[model samples]
Target: MLIRQLEYLVALGREQHFGRAAAVCYVSQPALSAAIRKLENELDVTIVLRGRRFEGFTDEGRRVVGWAHRILAERDALLADLDRMRNGLRATVRIGAIPTAVPATPLMSSLFSTRYPLARVRIESLSSREISRRLAEFELDAGVTYLDNDTPPGTRSVELYRERYRLLVPADDELARESVVEWAAAAALPHCALMSTMRNRRVLDANMAAAGATLVPVVETDTVGALYAHIATRRLASIVAHTWLHAFGVPEGMCVRPLAEVRPRPAVGLIVSDREPTSIVVDALVDALSGADLSEALERSLPPVIPG
Candidate 1:
């Protein structure tokens, strides 16, 4: 019924715990529960399944939650439109980015901020699948993720760059002497890499397979920082996106080399919902990035690999 009720419902659906949902909505548990009960009474449908705790949403509740997502998104868009009419753009643009794409978000955000100084940008490091899911659910305004593979449906994108792979090794390592490293050779080293669940790791696996190699990482982690830590300590080498080097530079005691085999690199870009009456913040972000030659800019900024 009320917008606040819908907000509480959406938060409950996302958190799946009464206390957590109440905390997110900035209300007491009893207040949030009363709002949901009032909503259910008005709709004449059982929205949530109940037990000692938050069990799950009913089938009808699932549909309601889906509609709630759109409604809240539209409400935000309306506010953004009015703000833009009176002042400059002044809305928070929530973005979910795959870890490999995380490094490149600043390139997009910096451009967005320069144009719309009042607008806020929030970035989250998420898996590719999560980015796709959140965008479809209106939880994310846009995403920075691989555009060439498993792109979310009903969305359009502006390709920023094609991501290339590189091998990272300690300066004292044997492979560090080479100007370029083959995938098979990189695979043979004691490797630390992203977890197999990540799309980036899957991409690396496919490339290595094409090169007659297989990745058997000595350690697997979800974060790039952990991978870098292993390589920096000379405990392991890693195959990582060139964007990582461009963003963070080579870790101390480590050097990067180009991969010898040139496979078709995946395009990483900004993706937003393609439906009519899109979010104004999303539109502003796309406009900010559409004309910029980010690929060239990132290439120019890529840190030089230290000599062996």
Candidate 2:
């Protein structure tokens, strides 16, 4: 089948609506439908289950879509390789990062851009699971996520740093003057935490559990900015990653204290698909990371947890 036909099929699989998929492919509805039909005839398999509206793909269609993803990814890789040979790394590197890892993304992106000025970098904050799914589906070139757990198979990673925690509290809070706060004490305060769905929240929960404490946050949210707002208003305290301080610094009305109980720091890193004939853009990013000293860079840029 033609590559354009496969493009239409993949877009259809993603959008799940005939009109929307056609729009994505920049084609008329009839044109997209006819191309898929032609593909089906050539393959001798019904790829779509049709009805009054856009029905889901057939069982065989799902298999075809899987192959389509692989083919399109390889095709893009081939084009990228040729472009690099001629133009020297002119492609966008799409990256998905967990929220906790978002602050560190600039370090990686800046390094890549400096090395390959013609290339572009796009970053999205996504859940670790979403990162893994998109990487597997060939939607992302790389990811920044926890490498110690839930890393997808068939991928390799390089650790950037170990993530440590701190208790962020309003400047007027009882523990605000302290250089460190014990987990048990922090858990007892009015606290807002990441939603349980986030892997960072799970890591926080496990760490608290190990410290003979449990977090029952007064409020739960998915974004760090929300947590920061709550603490700034003196509505709650929070356990946040040390990396966050590097991005946001301490909010004007707040301060962060290192957790008194030192636990195992989770390793956060860059992950890329391990399949052969890797994308050139991905290779450039990997090469950039090879010379990066993000761990030390982050530490030096961040003000002390308890400002002197």
Leading candidate by TM-score:
2
lDDT by residue for model 1 (36-117), tens: 9999999999999999999999999999998999999999899889989999898999999888788888888999999999
TM-score of every model versus the real structure = 0.94, 0.95
Error of 2 at 158 (Å): 1.2
Clashing pairs for model 1 are none
CA lDDT, every prediction?
0.88, 0.87
Q: How many backbone clashes does candidate 2 have?
A: 0
Worst 10 residues of 1 by lDDT: 227-236
Task: Give the per-residue lDDT of model 2 (tens digit) for 63-101.
Answer: 999899999999998999999999889889999999888
Residue 27 accuracy (lDDT) in model 1: 95
Off by over 4 Å in 1: 305-308
